[model samples]
Target chain A: MISAKLKERLIFIGPLIVLPGLIVAWPVLEVLWLSFRNRVQIFHIDRWVGAANYLYLFGEDLRFASAVSNTLYFTFVSVGLEFLLGLGFALYLRFSPEREWVKGMMLIPWVIPSVVSARLWQWMLHAEAGIVNYLLQSVGLTDAPIPWLSSPDLALHAAIFADVWKTTPLMVLLLYAGLLGIPENLLRAARVDRTPPFRMLFCILIPQLRPAIATAVVLRLLDAFRVFDVIYVMTGGGPANSTETLSLYAYRTYFQSLQFGYGSSVVVVQVMILAGLTAVAYRLLQGKNPAAAGDGPGEFHPRRTEVKE
Target chain B: MVPVKRKPIFRVETMARILIRSLAVLAILAGCARSGPLPDENKTVHYYQFSLPRDREAFDRLRTWFHEEHPEVNLQIHTLPTSSDDQHQFYLTHLGSRSLSRIDVFALDVIWLAEFARAGFLMPLDDLFPEREWEEFFPAPVQAATYDRHRYAAPLFVDAGVLYSRKDLLLKHGFAHPPKTWEELVKASRVILEREEDPSLNGFVWQGKQYEGLVCNLIEFLPSRNPFLTVAESPRLEVDRVRRALGFMRDLVVRFGVSPPSVFSMSEEESRQVFQNGRAVFMRNWPYAWRLAQQEGSPVKDRVWLSPLPAFAGDASGGKGALGGFLLGIHPESPAREEARAWVRFLASPRAQRVLWQDLGLTPARRTVFPDLPSRGIPLDVLRQVMESAVPRPASPLYIPISQSVQAYGSGALAGVYPIDRAIRHIESDMGRIMRVMH
Candidate 1:
């Protein structure tokens, strides 16, 4: 009963459905199933414990609570700083006379692998031999060396600083691309109308770049949420677990502790939290864009959309 | 309209072509996914172990010896990551996936013996060594390699914590011998720091980091009669002694002001670097630091000496170093069980142990090999004594979690983030919970 046209359509679309189902959906479902069991692989303890793991995480495990707070704090602070710094760099690159060289130089941090950068930062932040401490001491900034990675109060922030340094270049690249996409005529018109630079930035440039900013922020937010390598290298969630993010906690539980079921539960909750964040972000970012509402390419046309003038 | 009609036909043809090519690539990939090596004339046995750059020459020698010993076995050696944590994770992933046949023989850290054995990842090695043969290796490492009264691995090499001191500094400060007790160490360090009046020099440095090394240091700090935890019956932490040990650790930083605040972040390498640079009066580390301290370019060359770690003044038994080293074991699921056992036996032999000691500076687990090697110095005698007194960490299948609890709360206490009593209570309760769940 299959028509020739329908057969062709099915042939083209079948892999798209089958591939993700096998690769992504299957593992996710397996983990979700595991979350409901009390499965400690080493001990050969496997049984249905329905919500017991979740209950422990929510009601009892103090480490889980700290991990949640640490993840959120790390994600938001690092992403916020990255956005501001990235926007500033992007704007400078767009207007600077030495744009090509400056852009190339900015990519050094991004191009270096995160683990290497983290190790580099670890050495630089060492309380005794670190260049950062050495410089600070020489400049009479502080008498005692700051225990950047060792102190519980400062370890998470130190990790965040490393994360921002490594990833800010990515934000700059994306935002700069967005800047390049803005139509030239619109900015020319703003200049002709005698609009101030600040006003033009807020009214003309920002509104035009909303889609790009949203994309960059959401991308960085996703990356920052599941951060593992930098913190793993720098603090190892140590100095009393102050820098322990959810991903690190899950890794420690699943791999180190061999509490596979509880670890899966942590993962499931992390995914759910990430999903909720992504959805909210998508709605908030795409809500105002006419292109997102299916208004077509003409939405960006100067004549079709109202100009502030 | 004619061009648009042709577009659909063009798209269909291209899609079908792409699909065919993708299927071919995937089929080729799938063909290559078969496990284990191809069948060969010689029996293939895969060996996995971590080797540092310095140990490469020694390992090469051992490999040549192994090949000569077992020409019928095709021994493929794989270098694992140097970090113990990474190597542990690598084994967990492969073994957890039930890909057991991929690795026939592997080296395990001393602390991982019980955990790996209890998980049924290792082959029982009792048949490889007789009761008398077991006595050839150090008793501590032999004890560590056993689980549930069954031997699971063969001791390869041994390590124990020792105190490395600046010989000139101690003598200059009027101390004729190394400190025999913790009280003497503290008093000597105070005198040296005051008379030397060096702002950059620290009185003592040891691993206080929140890692397995911290547990090792803590074990050495505790009285020999009282261990941090006992797993003989139900697991229990000796709270009072642990508190006193942890209090002493914290006092070194917060009270004594002898050890740097940075000790809270140091590992073996960091502490060794400080000692080698001659910036610390005394350092708690392993025998390997001796070779490094005496290296040609080291600032402390010829001026450093080692002794057993100091004990509390009241304890007559003196200090106890935490035993550490690698052990060789066979994978139970490997089809080449005979070859795997042979490989382990060859590696643990006295000849191989001597090569390892002479070339790599690792303390051989075999007591007989010690006499065969040339005399290095007085440090060799001290290492032998320390190895005799070395105590193994608790032999429990739940050692990883137990260690984690100790590292977290213990470091918390040492870093002044948590009170010692509270940290001890937390560690005890955590261990109790771990035992209940795993049991």
Candidate 2:
């Protein structure tokens, strides 16, 4: 015997749970199961190995350590730079007279598929014939062309640079929306009191945009941590695996090396790390912005208002 | 008022009918999608191979000929990505499922024969071909296709790395011939670089990118004993040779400065571009580069000459190049086993090989096809010599992991990122781990 309200809630929320369970949870559980077995498909070896795969990854595989470090470096640096650049761009566009036109143009980099952009960067970073080198040499910046994609010292940074270029616009879009959600009257009131621009940004705008910033940073961090296409197209984890990230390493193990169990374990560990980070990030961000957890001026419920309309 | 009250019920009935009709259509569409396109009267045999845009016409002609010969069999061609790594991944995903019987026949790299054979993906060809038929192809490719004394594939074509030199550059430097040994090559390159005084010019170029090509280059650079062979027999002896070989490769760029710093990044096409543009004095590449270099308007077209790769001084195995090329194998789970066998046999036939060579510049695996064909400005005799001395990479089911370990460590050593000794140690350990786990 269900109440009318309870039955209505079940009708609305039931599919949301079942759909994700079927599509996402099932495959994840399968991979978890696979991670515990010694499954080398090519060798026809499938047996319960328990923690051996994880042990080997942590203890014996030097590449796995490097891959973890590379992934973290790529994620933090790329996401950090993107947040800063995106915030700056979002603010500038909000105030600029040609805001719509500039915003549209800013989307070109983000709009292009990552694989295509990576290929373009690969050509532009070509040591001998690339335009970047040509410009650098012509300006007397350096006599020899920099091996952007080839040098082990510089390849990961090159990948990060590409990631930043391609993804910063997403941050801009999110932050810009966050900016728009801010009540104009608050800024008007601050201006009436003779508030300085810097103070307004630090004390008002940033505090108001905390939720957006956190969401954008976490989203980009997760995406960048699992980055494969751009780096794959550009360096292929080469010049001695300097650009190899966790996802690339896992893929190589699964597909190229045919070590399904080991690859699964690598991915499982990566997922655990991601989950921990996401939890910490959500908590820290939400702790700072209590309004995100309740109905407050900072929280914009567009859907609720639209539903009433 | 009564008619209006009944109108709502009628509308509901019509709406439900439309919904049911659309859902039935969707269900039919989904069924079609699952079983693939509508069935044809002719028996279909699916074939998968890498795309070669340049040889599309030749391939079409071969398909037409195949269809004419076997009118009952419908040959469906599917093109895999050109990269061997991608193709290998595609096969692994498709064949691992054991349900993708649509792929009746596929092209396989020589090194993948052992792995695929061991995985039970490929059908043994021992019953398909007799002793006389097997003898038609070269021994190297034949040997490469066999695992546990059972032939698993039919060699469709063969490739061997060869040295391409600028005849004009060598003559200008007062050399009668291309370098016979690695020592002579370095000396000649030094002299040529000094005499030419061209900043754009490089002494030599080869595939040094961190991939399978690097492994091939490593094999070519090693001393006559073959380090890979010694690894199984005497691991101690292999270590020193591998170190020496790797050191010399690094020295060519760092110490001699002849092979430019950029060679660390160059693959076959990039190195060929340098040599073809007359910026490189010598290049090490596969036989395919010969046709490209001799094409009209190439800067070094008339001046280029092909020769065997140089070896260490006094090494008897100086001329050996790494064996490469593709073979055709039948899927063990394929429903149309007879049709797949026919397709593989047809592709490896002498007539088919001749067409592939004449039309597509592929080096034929059949020894008989080489006798009567016009050379078309290519040095056939020199190619034959290189092919005769061609050595295959280490034959093992674990070759992919082994190759990956070699490429990673070797590239690290070449780039000065990892010390040579450390790289070697990593390689040995990685190989040991791979072999242990697989076994």
Best candidate according to lDDT: 1
TM-score of chain A of each: 0.93, 0.90
lDDT by residue for model 2 (B1-439), tens: 0111324546878899999999999999998877956545236788899877676888889989998998778888888998888899998888778665468899999989888998888999987778898887888898888987899999989998899999999998799899889899899999999999999899999878899999888888888736464434222226787898889999999998889877888899889888888899999999988888989998887898899999899897666789998999998878788888999999999889989888878788887778887796799988877877788877778788878888888898899987999988888877766665654
Q: TM-score of predicted model 2?
A: 0.88
Where model 2 places Cα greater than 4 Å from the true spot, the runs are: A1-19, A290-309, B1-45, B54-56, B63-74, B127-133, B225-237, B333-339
> For each of the candidates, what fraction of the native contacts does it recover?
0.48, 0.59
The alpha-carbon RMSD values of the candidates against the true structure, listed in the order shown, are 6.2, 6.8
lDDT of each: 0.86, 0.85
Candidate 2 local lDDT, A1-309, one digit each (tens):
999999999999999989999999999999999998878876778888788788877887778888989898988899889999999999987766546568789999999999999999999988877899999999999997899988888999999999899999999999988887776666667888989999999988998888888899888878988899999999999888898888998898888998888789999999998888788877777677836545475444342111000
Candidate 1 residue lDDT tens string, B154-207? 998999999988999999878999999988999999999999998889999999
Model 1 steric clash pairs: none
How close is every model to the real structure, measured as TM-score? 0.87, 0.88
Where does model 1 exceed 4 Å of error? A1-18, A96-98, A183-185, A287-299, A302-309, B1-45, B54-76, B94-102, B333-342
